[model samples]
Target: MMKTMKILTALAATMATIPAVAHEIWVERDASGPARIYLGEPAEAVPEAGDPEFHHLQKPQAIQSDDKPIAFVRRANHIEATVPGSGDVRVRDDSVFAPWKSGEKMQGAIFYARAGRSETAAKLDLELVPAAANADRFTLLFRGKPVPAAKLTVITPDRWQKAFFTDANGGVEIPKLGAGRYIVGASHTEEGPAKLGGQDVASVVHISTLTFVR
Candidate 1:
């Protein structure tokens, strides 16, 4: 009993270090017809658009029938993107809080246009893409390479969430998905160059998300 209690205490402490936001990005249509970009957790509640921590790492990219460039319109709560043709739009928030005394945090977002499925818009730190051969399978990439054994959390249209791990090639297969809209998320952390609090350190967190409608 004492050993079990000690294990439980340790687990609790470890979980405390995790952030409450667990940010994610997705695109949804607004009343004006243009797609609006959101940054937050879709599984729990509407993204905290007003969260001060939400900021673009770089200019957002959009690929549609014309391959036009789209920019993020920063609003009081959330950001918006104008997709002219509707192919794929992506945004990266690189090292949003890098050089922190604790570590660095980054985010990537991908939106698949209803017209076709394709690769990520921007190959940032991490990426989640659909498998070429199977619609139910997916591939997770870290630093533009396959990431083996990475954890993937999937949220279905009905708000059902499940966790999965990648195979040797960073591939994951979801046997059951009736499909509507789905959000796939993956995160990885490693030791990397960082300047935090005026001191050099080695720690970074990379988070990526893929949002699609079937």
Candidate 2:
């Protein structure tokens, strides 16, 4: 009975350490600091329906792009870019608190093959080079869904870049993309072509749409 009791005690101690490995935001400074929480007050706690202070807090500056869509720039997060045509773009989400961190790099790619090739879907590999460690985060949206298409990897020598159809199989040959069309676009969570609140922020190349065909 003593031996069994000892084993059970050891197991309990090991299980106690699991919570430390999970990082969490807190409101207090104690070891088990106040956990980060979202506002969920009742409607009565909100100010008057049309109060100026309340409205101002919720209003977001709208941006415009002549014929292109605005990429999202996580509000309240900071990022920089050296590309001239790039400006602070719009993130595609409208959540109260966007989860992307500042300096996260963003990119996308599209593969195209001949209309009737035996291997129409090709596999490709690309590297992303960021200016700093943890400097950028990558979010890839393909056909409107987030997939492994990104090949998540450690930051490589060529971070902050993109490539398409890079495999050695005949599937990669340009001929395989028999005269068909494809669309690909990319944007940075931190950078943009226009200054915040500027009239022309939306038209920047922050949201780049590319069309390729054989």
Candidate 3:
């Protein structure tokens, strides 16, 4: 089961903009592949009327810096990113706004993930022992699309109760991604579903660096 605890708003704001300072940034799997360029927000707020990029985004001006990607992926909202220094920033809808409130400075994962090649997907099995009873629902996000539904399973502690998830594609399973390092895990949050903070006891399981192959 997952619990919702409010982190201090002051901290969240600080950790949201760490990716703006980078010399060179690009998401890479190995060598030859397409990596998205993370364009950052301006240092000082550019006038909304004068700024051409402002009106295009849901929340402009507040976008993090173009500093090298604190994390990397081909596209946005396809995978979860882990910010190394302070904390983490979860990407929800390919959004440009930071995941923090005003005045709240935070240090966590402040990177974003996006779909790359077909090789970025993988199969994962998680053993969830929640702090309390939960709805027993979670999502396996790879890049942005769900993994093969047949590959996901939720097993109860009793060893008898088991449930299988279904992909939108009738009986056919979702795509089995190619070979690459993918940040794989489960999330319940709708906005920042893959964004994880604090302890591992929460509803999400950010197990390891997932790599798929031929």
Candidate 4:
């Protein structure tokens, strides 16, 4: 029992380093229709933006509106891109690498986005999206492939949180939800070390997020 407790304690500590809402990027449309990229929890009263500490990767790249290139402007807290007419707009941030601890390395801060009813893959280290329009099922991908048994945390419009895991096909079924906004997040840590933050550390933790309105 003591050994089990120790393992659980260590797991908790590791998770503490990655906040429940950190490392997630999603698109939000203002009243006028222009899309803004936000970096934190979309469910927050005022979801935070940007990751100056860990966003050592290059600026957002491959920003597009239905395959047509769109320019992105960096703001104090978030990145903004104009949506052209919206069929399936997608954007991704540069991947950043950093030392998780002594001898462990991790790369992350990757983000992907698309608007409404479209189930496209961002093809990042990890990706999340709804299965279909008004669907309660979601799919997760790792390195552009299905991530079976991946764990996820889902936040509803009212801030209710639930824990779930992907099935054999990297899919998760969520409870029937009301219309507002939602955020689903997942993460994975690998044993191999990658060069990040100018040094070599231990393992790499990859985080992904998907946000949409019903």
Candidate that scores best on lDDT: 4
Write one digit per residue (lDDT tens) for candidate 3, span 1-214.
1232235453465555443322111122333332223232212223423333332233111122345454442233222243333211222222333333323332222223222223222232211111122212223453344444534322121222223454553122223233323222222222223443332211222221111112
Q: Output the TM-score of candidate 1.
A: 0.67
Give the better candidate number (3 or 4) by lDDT: 4
Candidates, ranked, lDDT? 4, 1, 3, 2
State the lDDT of candidate 1 residue by residue for 149-183, as single tens digits: 99888788788999999999988986567667677
lDDT of each: 0.59, 0.24, 0.28, 0.62
- Model 2 per-residue lDDT at 29: 12
In model 1, what is the error at residue 165, expressed in angstroms? 0.6
Best TM-score goes to which candidate? 4
Per-model TM-score versus the true fold: 0.67, 0.18, 0.20, 0.68
Candidate 4 wrongly placed segments (more than 4 Å): 1-21, 30-32, 47-58, 63-67, 75-77, 95-98, 102-109, 113-115, 120-122, 197-202
Alpha-carbon RMSD to native, per candidate: 7.1, 20.3, 17.0, 6.6
Clashing pairs in 1: 49-77, 50-77, 99-196
- The clash count for each model shown is 3, 26, 33, 7
Stretches of candidate 1 exceeding 4 Å from the true structure: 1-21, 29-33, 47-68, 75-77, 103-116, 120-122, 195-201
Q: Which consecutive 10 residues in model 1 have the weakest lDDT in total?
A: 107-116
- Give the Cα error of residue 140 in candidate 2, in Å: 14
